[model samples]
Target chain A: MTPQSPYALALRQTGDVRDRADFLDQWRELLAEAVDRLLQSGVTGGTPCASPHGPKTDVDAQKTAVLILAALHGGSTLSQLAQDPRPLNAALDLALVSFVAAEDNTAARTGTSSSISKLDL
Target chain B: MTTVDSRSGRRLTARGEKTRAKIVAAAADLIYVQGVGATTLDDVLMASGVSKSQLYHHFAGKDELVRAVIDHVGERIIERERDALGHVSTIPGLRRWRDALVQNNALRHGAYGCALGSLASEVSDQDDAARRAVSQLFIEWQGLLAGVLRRLQDGGALPPEASIDQLATGLMGAVQGGYMLAQTARDVTPMATSIDMALAHIESLSTD
Candidate 1:
């Protein structure tokens, strides 16, 4: 027998179908918002505000940017990880570490930390 | 005293420090809302009102900005947890700490998960510093909770064998798991159940 998802069980217990649908929609919105934020932060190339922007500078910095963006983008995958029984968690741990190190080093050299003031958002 | 830029080899000015603070604040807010990957130097520049040259003058590029953001995130988490859980080191503090954490999450309706955990979930596969920072934060947080448990043990309210580290790690996992579950279900059961389960586990361990 296939195992039911914790989310599926949750949906079943809801007496109000409309409420359930609304809840699911809201959750999706939240997840999307999260994903958008991470992508904007620059997990991949082609997006504006990427660390090195276009190519030709440093290959490592560009790769670092990609990993950082990818890590943030991974938020959507939590459900998959939650269900998986393998060493997925360890892999995630390693990936996140690499992203942070890369991002931090690039930022440290860039002096991005030294400019601008407060963000209203 | 002068601080040399690791990349540019230029001396950092006091004004430069101020500008960096501004950039960090702006980047942090952008990352907080947009999740780091989605935020851009353009966003930071706009939010910070810093010109392009000014941005470049400060950060060599966007990667530098992200590093500052992570550092800021770390400092903020440490301070917040310190303030929030400061009272947990006493014999009568266990229940209070538990309630504070539960109520705080409930008040947010689970919309705001732990920022570090959020980042970890987002980038654990790619950022070593961030991964380490998140792990450090968890370890620090767990230590605080464990300290409280140790106090209880000292007061004879808990068993001497009570492993605070294990319990604290368990609590952290539950909270992260709970938030994810709650987000998926768009309901509070995951949050509520996780808290209830953790609380039940703690109580069962109590010798009182």
Candidate 2:
């Protein structure tokens, strides 16, 4: 996301949100929509676990989306601190591990330079 | 031993040291609650009960004082994590560490988020020095978590092929991300779910 994006601003916000409940609710909805789109793209790439075509897969994708969203929000903060992209990459890699094809997962686990490592998050 | 103030290039006596520590602690608390942008030197002075000259004597300006606050907060967090996760070697130990973190945030209803993380988010773009300080603390924090994962690997719990450092980094992301979401939602469910998902992933890799 761009630095000026609402998500980016929210990620960096440290103030109290007790008075902005409606704003937060809308932000969460927007984030969830974005996550759903990302998961749809991942599914189209033949990642079965994240496919939105089936009921069970839809639930799994929702769960995975939450993890991915968390990683993005959390990882981006760390990435800013270190001025390095590896933390974000590593975080996204792990969050998406469950949906990765079996062979790719093994490749990642064994440190064999999988596509997950190439993610430019 | 005489402690020297790095910014002022002055050696501090015991009383001077105590005064400096009090200022830093107060500033840290203010920054934690109101954020760096909203917090001012005057507020810090009021909260710390130190004169303007005394505050300046210890720090060059607000930026310098902020750096000091970063160090002070980082040290406190690292010390607490060391105590909590020092001997954690099994999945249950890791879960207990997670539980304590979640429970602590629940007390504030996830209002304040992680102390070091909230500071990192606020000052990272504006203050490069403070960013580096916070980055160092995160590295140390990640290292502590990696140590626990390494122990699990060595004990034949986690597979030998697993990368402890990456797993540790992922876990830290989950935590910080969880805290952010939890703070925004004013509920601990998001934080708990985020962390539990990361832990579950690790657990799925367990051989024992």
Candidate 3:
């Protein structure tokens, strides 16, 4: 991603004020859409776990979306630092674990799964 | 071991060491707030109140100074993390660590992001030495987390089949990612949630 990307700008704590605000809004929207799609995929079975900080409503998707995006941004930075992809993969896996189907999750926990492929992100 | 100037290759006297530390602390604060690219040596000189010759005596140039700042910041962060994560061997201990992180970030609403992570994003592509230093620090930080997970495994909190290294790496990612999200949102909710999710994943793997 470019240094101007939302994640980069956020990490560096730099960028124009207006641009930062716009990017934040755009990022939230994009992640929220992705979360909605994941939810619609029946992975969460239309009844995801309640978010600790959010009401027991559709807002859970929005919150979950933020968490996933955070994981990507954070994990990618670590990956870049270490020159290894394991950090990113593990972080993303944990971020989206709740969305995995039960059988897939069991398989994953057993080290014999491709549950990440199911999300198709 | 006596600390020597990286550029001059001369050991520092007590007074010289104090001056060098003053410069590094000033640079770290400036870099943390404004970023590496935006921070100029002139700003550091002004902030540190060091003469030009004194600054040059300690560092070869801005790049060297930045590297020093990276180490300074990294050490500070890692030391704090080690202290906090040292006693964590249970899920509740992990959550307490998470709460302290979130609470600390909330003080400034995460406007500053993480010190090492922010430095990594800014310098990883531009400065090879800085990148390596940051990479080393991350490895150390990850190792600390892995140690905690290993403790959990030894205590039967986690299953033998659990990959403690991967879990530790994921937790570190969650922390760094949470810091970025909080910085972006100017709120700690995202930070708290990101870390909580990672902890939840680890808890899911708990044998108890």
Whose lDDT is greatest here? 2
Clashing pairs in 2: none
Interface RMSD of every predicted model, in angstroms: 15.7, 2.4, 2.5
Better of 1 and 2 by lDDT: 2
Q: Tens digits of per-residue lDDT for model 1 on B64-138?
A: 667667767877877877776665655446556556655766665655455665665655555666556555665
Model 2 bad stretches (over 4 Å): A1-10, A14-63, A101-103, A107-121
Listed in order, each prediction's TM-score against the native is 0.58, 0.84, 0.87
Scored against the true structure, residue A4 in model 3 reaches a CA lDDT of 33
Model 1 residue A26 CA deviation in Å: 16
Deviation in angstroms for B40 in model 3?
0.5
Winning candidate number (DockQ):
2
Write the number of the candidate with greater TM-score, choosing between 2 and 3: 3
TM-score between candidate 3 and the true structure: 0.87
Evaluating just chain A, the predictions reach TM-scores of 0.33, 0.51, 0.61
